[model samples]
Target: MGAHQITIVDMDIVETSNLHRQALYTEDDALNMVPKVHAIKEHIARINHHVDVQTYYQEITSNNIEDILDEVKPDIVIDGMDHFKIRYLINEVCHKHQIPWVYGAAVGNKGTVYGIDFKGPCLKCLLKQMPSSGESCAINGVLPTIITQVASYEVAEVLRYLSGEGFSKKLITIDTWHIDFKAMNVDILKNHACEICANQHYSLLETKHQQHIESLCGRTYLFRYQSSIFEHAHHLPGEIVKSTSFAKLIKDDDYEITLFKDGRMNVYGIEDDEEAFKLYHSYLKALK
Candidate 1:
C-alpha cells in the first residue's frame, strides 16, 4: 500500500459530461477532446511523481481482458463501469484469480459500494441472475456529487484491503441529495447458492462475448476517438453539437446523429434501427 502502481483502462474520451464527476479532467480537456485514460495519466503524474501509472486507451472486452490483466498485474481492480455485462466479466476474472476488487456505482443522487474479495461475496451473490435490461447512466443521469462519494468509498475499501485491515463486506448505500447512508447486511446473499463464488464456476471467463462492431474487418478501431473539430477547422454538416476522435455528432431539431470515421453511424433521434441505417447509408452515398 505504501508504494503501489495503478492501471487505468477506459476507451472513452473526455467530454463536457465527464468534467463534472471525474476530477481528472477539466473544461479545457473536454473542449480539446482529450482521451480519458491519457488525460487522467497526466493528472496523476502531476499529483504524484512517484506513482507508476499505466493507461490503456481501449475498451474492456472479453478478447483483451486476459492480456491487459497479465501486462498490468494490478494488486486490486476498481469498478468504474456502469454497464453490467462488463461488471460480471470483471467479477468472474477477479474471483477466478483470487484478486480483490471494489465494486461501486452511482446514479442520480444515489450510489452503492461493496468490497469483493475471494472470501467475501462476489457480485453474483448480490443479483443472483443477470438482469434483463438496464437503465444506463446515459439515460438516467448521474450527479457529480454522487459519483465522487461512490469513488471515495471505493478508494477507502481499496486502502483497507491493501493495508490488511478489515473492510466492510456489506453493501454500502448512500444518497447525497437526501444525506442518507446505510450498510445493508449481505450475509444471506453471501451464503446463498452463488454459482460464481460457491461452485467457482466463472461462466464469463469460459465464454466469448460476441462483439457487435460496426467497423469493417480490416479496419482498425481508433485508440483515441476525438474529432478534429475539437481543435481543428471543420466543414461538417448540422450544428456540430459534439465532436470526438472516433465520431462527429451533428444534431438539429429534427435529427440527432453521430458519424464515425470508420464509416459507422447511429441516429438516436429516430426510433427505427432500419431508418437509422437508411439515414447513415444515404449520408454515406451523399458523401461519395
Candidate 2:
C-alpha cells in the first residue's frame, strides 16, 4: 500500500522495555531517550523518503482528538493508542466524523483486533463499563509476536477498507503464545442500543474528566485522573531537582520528571503513562 502522508502522535518518549513489543523503536532510540513520535518519524523517513511523515508529540485525549483528526484528515486512522479511555475517545470522534478506524489492543500474549467502519459494533458495544485502571501491555506484559500480529492485521483491515474490499466485522482475537486465532461474533451491537452507534453523540469530546494541570505553554503533557496525594511544593518527598512557583522538576535516572504540589506529574524522557506512573508511585512510596 502506498500512502502519501502519515501522521504519528504520542505523548511519551522511548523506553528500554518497549523495544521488545514496540517494533518501530530500537535500543539506540531508547538509550538516546528520544520521544516516540520523533524516533518513529525519523525511522519512517529513512525507510521511505517518498512517503510524507508527520508526527505529533502529544497524547491523544478527548480534548485534542477531534482537532488532530481534523488536521490530519487521513484516509483511515490506525489505533496505536495504548488504553481504553483514549481508544474510546478515538472511537467516538472517528464515528462522529464519519471516519473509519481500526481498534486493536494486546496484553499477555493475547491480542484483539476489530474494524469500526462507522457502521456497526463500535468499541462501546464491547466495553459497556470502562475500568478505572485497565490492564495494559506494560502491566500485564506482552510478546512482540502478538503486537506485530495485531498491528499487521489492523493494517490489512485499513487497506481493505480503503481499497473498497471491506473488512470482517467479527471480533478477531489471537493467542500468539498458543498459536490460536478466533474470529467470533459479538452481539452487543445487536442487543444494546449504543448511544455512539445509534445517535451521533460523542460526549467525550466535551468532557473534561481527566485531571490536568497546565502551567507552562508547551513544556510537558500531564494527564492523571487521580486526586491529589501531596498538598504543597515543600512537601515533595523526592529530592527536588529544581523548584518554581508553577511546578517542581525532579531528577530520575530513567525519567525527566516534573511534579506539582497537588500530586500531578509531567514525566518526560519515557514512553507511555504506565512507566511514568510506576516512577511516580515509587517516589510516593519512598517519601512514605
Candidate 3:
C-alpha cells in the first residue's frame, strides 16, 4: 500500500446503487454526481496525503490509451475494468510496453486473480477469444464481500511483483459464499501460438476492433462515438437535466443519456441490445 504515485482512469459517475460495494464513495458523492476517478482521488488524498494520485476523468479507448500510458509511465498496471474489451486493450498495450499487470474479476460470489509479468502467459494466452456471453455484476448480482476479497488478493499480487518476489503463475479462484478456493497452475495454459504474447500482435489496439458500445451495470449501456456531444447539444431531442463543461445529461421518456465532452455516452433504462443500438444510431445521426 506504500506506493509513491498512482494514476486512475474512469468515466463513470458515482451512483447510490453502487455505494454498498464501492466503499470509497458516499451518498453525498452520488448526490453531487462526482466522477468515479475524481471521487477516488479525493478519497485517496484524505487517507494518504503523500500518495500522488493522478486522475483521468475519461474512458480508456484505443485512441487515448497510448497517450495516457506514455504520460503515466507506470511501473505496473492493475485491472479494475468491468468489461473484457478494455482489459484486452490494456493487455495489448502493457505487453507491448513490457509492463507488468495484475488481473482481477469478481461476479456473483465468484472471483479470479492472476498476475502477468509480460515474460510469461498474458491474458490473451489464457483466453484465446472473448467469451461469447458477457456476464456482469449488474445481471448476476455481486456480493460486497467478494469485491473486497478479490481486491485484497489483487493488491497482494501487486506487492509481490513490486518487491521482486515473482508471481505464483497460478490463477486464483474463489467463491466466498461457498467458502471454496482453488488455484490453477496457468503455466500449462500458456499458448505458444498466442497472437499477442507470442507473435507480438496487438489486434485490440487497431481502430477496426475498437469497442464502441458496452452494456454496463444496472441496465445501462455506454456508447463511445467519435464526435463531441457539446457540438450537437442543441440538436438533441431531450430535456436537459444537467449541463456542465465536461458533460451533459439529457432525459427523455424512454432513456436517460449523459454525454461527455470526449464523445462517450451513458444511456440508462434500456436492456435490449437492439433498442440500445437504435438509440445510439439516432444520436449519431443527430450529431452528424
Q: List TM-score per model, in order.
A: 0.78, 0.76, 0.91
Residue 37 in model 1: lDDT: 81
The 0-to-1 C-alpha lDDT of every candidate, in the order given, reads: 0.71, 0.71, 0.85
Candidate topping lDDT: 3
Which of 2 and 3 is ahead in TM-score?
A: 3
Which candidate comes out best when scored by TM-score?
Answer: 3
Ranking 1 against 2 by TM-score, winner: 1
lDDT order, best first, reads 3, 1, 2
Encode model 2's per-residue lDDT on 136-179: one tens digit a residue.
Answer: 53366678788899998998888889899877777899999899
Local accuracy of candidate 1 as per-residue lDDT tens digits, 1-288? 444578899866676866667887999887766778888889988988898888887667777888899988888999998667788999989988888999998877899999998887889988777653334544557888999899989999888988888567779999999999999876766855678888988777778754432221111111222333233314334677666665566676766554544443434455443554555545544454
Residue 269's lDDT within candidate 1 is: 52
lDDT of 2 at 93: 85
lDDT of 3 by residue, 1-288 (tens): 589999999987887888999999999887767888988989999998999999998778888999999999999999997788889989999999999999998889999999998888999988887753346656678898998999989999899989889777889999999999999998888899999999998977876455567777767888888755577877777888877666778888888888877788888898788988888888888878
Better of 2 and 3 by lDDT: 3
TM-score of 3: 0.91
RMSD of each: 5.9, 7.4, 2.1
